[model samples]
Target chain A: MAVVLEVEGLKKKYGSLEALKGISFKVEEGEIFGLIGPNGAGKTTTLRIIATLLTPSDGKVTFLGFDLKKHPEKFREKISYLPEEAGAYRNMKGIDYLNFMAKFYAKDEAEVREFVERAKRICGLGERLKDKVGTYSKGMTRKLLLARALMTKPALAILDEPTSGLDVINSLEVREMIKGFTREGVSVLLSSHNMLEVEFLSDRVALIDRGEILDSGTPQGLKEKYQASNLEIVFRSAVQ
Target chain B: MKNFSHLLIKEIKELVNKQLVISLVFMLFIFNFIGNVTKSEIKKAMAKQKIAVLDLDKSEISKNIIGALNMANFIIEEKSGEKEQVVKELRSSGLDLLVVIPAGFGQEVSNFRPGEVETYSYLKGISMTGSRKSEIVKALLQTTNEFLSNEYLKKKLPDLDPKLLKAPIKSREFVVVRDRMAEGSTSAVIGSLYAQSFILPVILMMIIMYSSQMVITAIAMEKQNKTLETLLTVPISRTAVVMAKMLAAGIVGLLSAAIYMYGFRNAFSFNTGDIAKAMSGVAPILKQLGLTITTQGYALFGISLFLTILVALSLATILGVLAEDYRTAQSLTVPLVFLVLVPYFVSLFADINTMSLPAKILVLAIPFSHPFFAVQNIMFGHLNMLWLGIVYNFLFVVVMLYWTTKIFSTDRVLTMKLKWGKRKVVL
Candidate 1:
């Protein structure tokens, strides 16, 4: 598979603290790659850098062979990023939010309507599309955000803590949606603290700790390498 | 290009969703209505004065004086009782003024000696209200003196030329600038009063209330919603986001200003003829004060106001970045309002040329002050000061924009922590 994203020697510092320390990674097309870590493991920071949200102190990132610094607009056009605990304008209805997202892709009104309909069905929004987002539950808002991210049908989707606040059912639904993306030859780079989510959705996993990747492989491969039966034990052993 | 268009659409959508546009329109309607109503009341009150006449002489000359006063717009009320009743009324504030003609006034005047007419009013007892009434009475007496002199010359010197009796020292009052003279009509006075007491305050209120809160809340909202991070991830430059926000704010500010001005004009039943005449004289004065507004002065005024608002909004954005929430953003507006009001108060109390050096410096430093000063200069025909005001206002806007953009571009604005009084630190 073609490499959809590449990062080299990524380093970021905030005052006296180093959030990212010369970290590097690659995400291939048609793969669900998860960066799993603890609460302060810099998973979100890494994802932010990959999404072009933060400028790395010393590093280079290229998305689909386009340098982030040189062609950020082009890279943004090809990818959709959902930050951790992402929020939508609460006063706008779900469908309006969807249409608003679709506008970034230059989709006509008719195209937006059709796209929102498809996204709504896939996200199981149903009649809730007419209600203001402020009235939505945490899981519902997450679903709405996921639906909006998918509406553009970009080649690469970057999701940070995509199901952090979701219920089990919504989490499973999100997992299914992410799986659907891989089936359609689209790439995904997801960061999460949920080991179970990582084991279930990611075809490949990178266990990161303190801004550095401790280990990288398939979930089962990481478990086998650490001589553990589960990815959780592998993560614990790797961190130690 | 497509993404920029999308960004603009999303901004407009968010602005609409916030219901700011609707609220501003409503505010404009209500404020304008109140301003116009107040203006009309003031105009009606100033139209004419009521005067009390005490004809102690009961002579034809005194009667003729009373007749002339009655013919002129004064509501003349004759006191039938004694001098005590008239004096009591004047002191009690029941009468604006008392015109007391002495018993021998007609015989003395016919003998060619100066006839005395006494006017009485309680000056020190009452406040401005009583004082203004006394001043008006004094002015009427001066007019009466002039009329008496003219009448005496006409009657006694029938064979002599009337022009020869005219004073040797003839004074011709030529206004330095004539444009403002045309606005001397009733409507012009009303319009100017409205512009001062109503239009200026409303404009300041709208600019401070909306621009300060809106700009700050917009930035803080993005931060709270975590959308700032998402937007930062986009390929667009960070400066682009700031520019987009400023542009959005400018649009909102201009829209609110237009709505307020429109409502003001419509609600007041503006007399266009008076405004035109007033504006003509006002134009040259405005030019002198550093503002050159032509027949199309309204357009220029609108543009200057828009630019001034944009500068204010940009400053608000910078202040907003320092705020962590909507409430903090709102509290920040108080100082902003004080800053805007300083210039207005200075313009009100001090003349353009005679303003204290510090006041002049402060006014020159503030963009909004120039507009206030320029508007007055234009209306009053102070041409020399108008250009200086316009240039200073323009420069202030430009400098503010540059500084605000710099502050926005720096990461310090986004990450800086705010410290509260003594106990807590707010982000």
Candidate 2:
């Protein structure tokens, strides 16, 4: 399979504290790859660096034949990044917000309309999309943001917590949607701390602790390698 | 460029929302309400004032004094009661003032000695109208003194012209601006010019203050909402992003300034109209003195004003990136607010032309000072100085925009931290 993203020796520092210490990962085409860890395990830092929101202090990210440092705009052209708990313009209707964001990616007005129409159907807010985004519930906002990320249909999508802050039902719906998107030849690099959820979702899973990836393989492969039942026990056994 | 336009349109829509429109309408209504109340108060102050008079002399000069006071818009009511009693009962009896003409007062005036007229004024609360009423009474009394003195002079100098005897010297004042001169006092010409063009500086200040604040708030809200991270990763030129935000903020700032100017004009329309009418006789003199702004001068001033506003907006954009949330945005704007306030107050209280060298340099160093000095610069044809100001403002804006774009391009936009305390990051 063609690789969609490559990260090598990625190191990020905030002030004097090292956040990510030489962590490496790769995302291949048409696969759901998850970086699983605790709250302060550098998952967000790694995702942000690849999304071009932060510069890696000591390494490189190559995406779609473009170096992130040298050609960030080029990297941006083929990817969509959905931050954890991201928000839309509060004063705009959900449909209008989608339209506004769609223009930045679309080549013409027709493409913008197509993107927004896809977003409307994917979000499933229906008449609720006519109301201002400020009035949306947390689950509704997360769903809308998920729909926005997929509507662009980019070559790669960097999702930081794709189902963050959603209820059980909403979480299931979002997981199904993300699974559906990967079937369309779009690769994904998502980060989360929900081990069970990630084990159920990612085709390949990486167990990260502090700032380093301790082990990485398919969920079943890691579980078998560590002689554990689930990916969570595998992570505990790998840490030990 | 197309994405830039889309961002600009989105920014404007976000700024001019339903809540903002409703707030602006409410503000205008309050302004108009206050304006009408002030007009009624001013009219009451200008109406005829009632005064009580106690005449002990019962002489012809006393009668003449009372008649003169009555003719000068005072409704005189004679009182024969005790002096202290009449004075105490002045305002409670619908009188604003009390005058006592003592016995033999007319004899002293008849013998060419100045006689004193005792006056007691009722106390009123400290307000503009209250002071205006007091000033009217005070002015009428001075005029009456002049009349009495002229009468005495006529009687004393029977063979000579009393008018010429009273003023030994006659002089005419003329004001000059560059080579052009007009037959008027310099102060009068300056006053007329200020009266007509003060609104420009006021509007400039309002636009800068309102617009910069709006930018900071917008950036802060984006941060608070956690939307900035997603926004920065989008496929658009970062420089274009900065430009779109600045331009949208500039447009909204102008809109806010327009609404504020409308409210301000409505509040002071009566006073401004009165001043224009009072200075009507000096209109030709003002023109001769070159105190008016020409078309070319106005165009130049407008450019300078635009550049200054851009400079403010650019600085504001940089400051806004440092803000952590909506609550932190207000304190972050303090520095920019101080920059605007310095020029505004200095231009109001001191003349930049006549200021000391150090003070003048300091004032002109502020980019906003250029528009505040526009009136004097246009009047004196200080085209070189004005052009220098234009260049300075342009360079200032460029430097600020470059710095802002640099921040946006780098990881500084994400990791930049600002804190009120040494160890805590507040914004």
Candidate 3:
């Protein structure tokens, strides 16, 4: 498979504290890749760098053969990112927000409207289309965000804590949606604290701890390598 | 380009959603109405002063004195009472001035003796009203004395021509410069005041309303929503992003300025007759000032004014990054307003030619200051200074743009975390 995202020697520091230290990884096209770690394990930092939101202290990221540093615009054109706990403009209606997101990609109004309808259907936002986003429940908002990310059918969609704050039903729905991406030959780079969700959706997982990737493989592969029954055991064994 | 257009559309839509459009329209209506009404009131007030005359000697000289006083715009009310009543009336608010003709006033004049007429007003303190009334009384007395001298000359030389005895060289003044022709006319005074009073308040309001909290909130909202990160990753150049934001801000500022000017124009009550002809004469003076402002000059002036507003909004965005919240951003706006107001205050109090060197330098160095000076210079026909002020304004805006871009480009400005106030990052 062709490599969709390539990171080498990625380093980041917040003042005196190092957030990411020389982390490197490659995400293959048409695969759901997961970066699972503890609360402060540089998962978001790595995602942020890959999204071209932050400059690395010392490293390089290449998206589909384009250097992110030198050609961020070109790299960004192929990627969509939903930050962890991202908030929506409360006053804007659901359909309007969807249309706003579509503008980043679609040139014509017809294309924008078509994409907005698709996003609405995918996110189950039909009845709540005209409702203000501020009135949405957490699960509804999460679905809306997921819909926004998927609107343009970007080559690489980066989702940070995609299921966070979601109920069991919405969580299942989001997981199934993420799993559906791989079937369409779309690449995904998702970060999460829920090992089960990561194991179920990610074709391969990178278990990160203390700003470093401690282990990386398919769920069964990591389980066998760590001499464990599941990814939870594997993560526990690797971090310990 | 598509992304830029998208961003611009988003900005305009947001402006509409936020009700800034409604508020701005309302402000324009109120400001215009007030501006026009104040001008009308000033004109009415100027036409309404009352004068009282105390005639001790009811002679031809006293009658002529009353006639001259009445000939003026004043409403003359004659009184036959003690000097004290006239003094009382002058002290009261009803009377603007009182003229007392002495008992020997007519006899002294016939005998070739110097005569004295007393004028009184209760108005005290060094105010424009007091000074104006004193000037009017003095002028009336001087004219009366001249008429008495001509009478005495007629009496002494019965065959002497009274017309020949009149001052050999009498002067009649015509307004040479079109802009200056309004001098001493209600329009001129009102025009200068109109230009001044509205410029500062409206500019300050525009800067604070559109630039301060609006820019801060927009940026902070992006940061909060995480949309900023997604936007940065897009193929659009960072410079383009900043330019788009500045452009958006510039549009808002221009809209606000247009609203203000509309309000002021609606409020202004100048006589339209001969105004165009008068304005034409000032065209050469305007040209010398680097203005070249005909009606077309006003159009160019509008363009420059829009540029200056763009620069101001850009500077506001640069300052806004330092603030963490809407309140902090708003608090910081006070100093910015004060800075803009300094030029207006100086222009108001200081003589244009005798301003302190530092004030002159500061005024010339600031974009906002130049407009105040430019309008005055254009009106007064100081073409060289006007041109200098325009150039200085242009340079100041350019330099500010460079600095704003520099501040935007710095990495620390984007990522530097600011807690409450231990020490702010210097970026």
Candidate 4:
């Protein structure tokens, strides 16, 4: 399969602290790649750099043959980034927020309507889509944001902690949607602390700690190589 | 450009929120209602100057002086009580003046010597009225002295005409304007002009201050809500983003200024009507002074005023980006508030034309000061200064907008944090 995104020698420094030191990874077409790490393990920083929201101190990120640094706007057109703790405009309705996000990709009213319909079906917000995002519950908001990310049908989706603060039911729903992305031939770069969820969703995983990638392989491959029963034990073994 | 319209629409919609709309309407109504009330009060006739006299010398001359005070539109209340009691009443009643005649006052005047008639003045505060009335009283005293001396001369030269002795050379004062004699005090006519020019700056300040604050708060809200990151990631250029924000904020500011001007104009235009009526007799003088501004001049002034407001909004936008939250944003606006108020107070009293070179340069250096002088410059046909001010303001705003756009393009906008001691405040 062709590689959809390539991140090589990505180095990010915040003041004197080096957040990402020479990190590299790649996501194949229609593959779910997870960066599994602890807090402050440079997971979000790497995603932010890939999203073109932060410029790397030293790195090269190529998305679909386009250099991200030199052509961030071009990269933005083919990718959707959902930051951790992202919020929609409070005064805007759920449908309105979807339509707003859709306009960035759709050219005409008919295309925008089609995107909105897809987002509605994915979110399953039904009747509550007309309510302002400010009035939505946390789970419902997360679901709507997930739908927003998928509605554009971008080539790559960068999600940072997609299910960080959701309950069990919402987490399941979000995981199901993320799994649905691969079926549509959409590549994903996700970061998470929940090893079990990462094990279930990620086709391949990278064990990262202290701004360095310790290892990268299939979830089952990492587990077998570390003589571990699961990906969590594999992560602990590799990082420790 | 496509995203610019979307962003601008979103910004304007946010600004015209229900709470802000209510506040705007409330400000409009209160300003106009109170303005009308104050307008009518100013139109009323001047109140009488209350005076108290402790006349210890019960002579004809002292009585004549007291009568003269009363005839000068002063309400003289005779207080025969002790000095302490008189002083207490003087302080309590807010009297304008108090005169104490010594017991031998009549004897001194009869001897043709300068009498020591003590006068006490009770002025409430700094006002033009108190000083103006004091000047009038001083002139009256000089005339009274002349009357006494003239009486002495009439007795010594009984055969001479009394009129010739009192006025050796009669002179008539005439104000010449463009070879035409004009009526009305020069001070009154100038005061009317100054009053007309004064209000424009105040209205401009209200618009700039209020609108700048809104822009700051809006940017701060985007940061607090974590929406700025998403916005920056959009496919739009940074310049387009900054332009959208500035244009939207400018639109809101103009709307607010329009509403405020509507209220203030109705209230102040009433007083202006009275001034126009009173100043009709001094038209030739006004024309000679080149104090009549054409509509084209007003249009130029309006442009300068708009540019001044844009500079303020641009500065506010920069401050907003540096702020961590809404509270920090408001604190950051202190510099802008000072910039506005300093010029506001100075323009109210200082005649910029007569200021020293250094003072004039200092005032003109502040971009806000130009708007304060807009009406004055236009009225006096100071087109050079007006055009210079407009250019200066335009350049200032352009520079600020460029800087603001550069800020928006940088990563510093997201990473810049205000450090408070050991803690870092990041939005």
Which of the numbered candidates is closest to the native, going by highest DockQ? Answer: 2
Q: What is the C-alpha RMSD of each candidate to the true structure, in Å?
A: 6.2, 2.4, 5.9, 5.5
Q: Could you tell me the TM-score of candidate 2?
A: 0.94
Pairs of colliding residues, candidate 2 = none
What are the per-residue Cα lDDT tens digits for candidate 4 across B1-427?
5767888898888778887789878987888888767655544214566667898888888898888888887777887967667877778675677788878788888887778676777788866556656765677677777777777777778788777876799765454544445544677667767655666677878888877887888888788877787777766787877777777888887788778777777765645676677677666667765667788987997899889878988898888888878898888888888888877988887889899999889888989988788777777667799999999999999899888887787667777766555466654
The residue ranges of model 4 lying beyond 4 angstroms of the native Cα positions read: B32-185, B265-275, B353-361, B378-388, B420-427
Q: Which stretches of candidate 3 lie above 4 Å from their native place?
A: A14-16, A89-91, A107-110, A131-141, A163-183, A194-201, A219-237, B16-18, B46-57, B79-139, B149-221, B224-226, B268-314, B332-413, B416-420
Model 2 ranges off by over 4 Å = B127-130, B270-279, B423-427
DockQ each candidate and list the results.
0.43, 0.81, 0.44, 0.54
B274: Cα error in model 2, Å: 4.9
Best by TM-score: 2
Give the alpha carbon lDDT tens digit for every residue of A1-240 in model 2: 998899999999887889999988889999999999989999999988888888889988999888989999987888899999799888888998898888889999999999999888888999999999999999889888888888989889888988888889999988988888899998988999999889988999899999999999999999889889998899889889
TM-score of chain A of each: 0.96, 0.98, 0.97, 0.98
| lDDT of model 3, residue B25 | 79
Considering DockQ, where higher is better, how would the candidates rank from best to worst? Answer: 2, 4, 3, 1
Query: True contacts preserved, each candidate?
Result: 0.58, 0.85, 0.47, 0.42
Residue-wise lDDT of candidate 1 within B44-144, one digit each (tens)? 44656677888889988899888877766678888767887778867766565778888899889877688888787655553445565566667766777
Candidate topping lDDT? 2
DockQ of 2: 0.81
Q: Candidate 3 lDDT, tens digit per residue, B1-427?
A: 8778777767655544546777777877887778766766566556746777789988887787788887866778888788886687567566667788978888887778988898887665544555566687798788778787777787888897776767667554333344443213344444434443445445544553455445555555555554565566555666666677667766665566667666665665433443555555444433443433357445545655655666666667666666655556666567667767766676666655677787677666666665555555655557678677666667777877777666655455466444547756543
Name the better of 2 and 3 by TM-score.
2
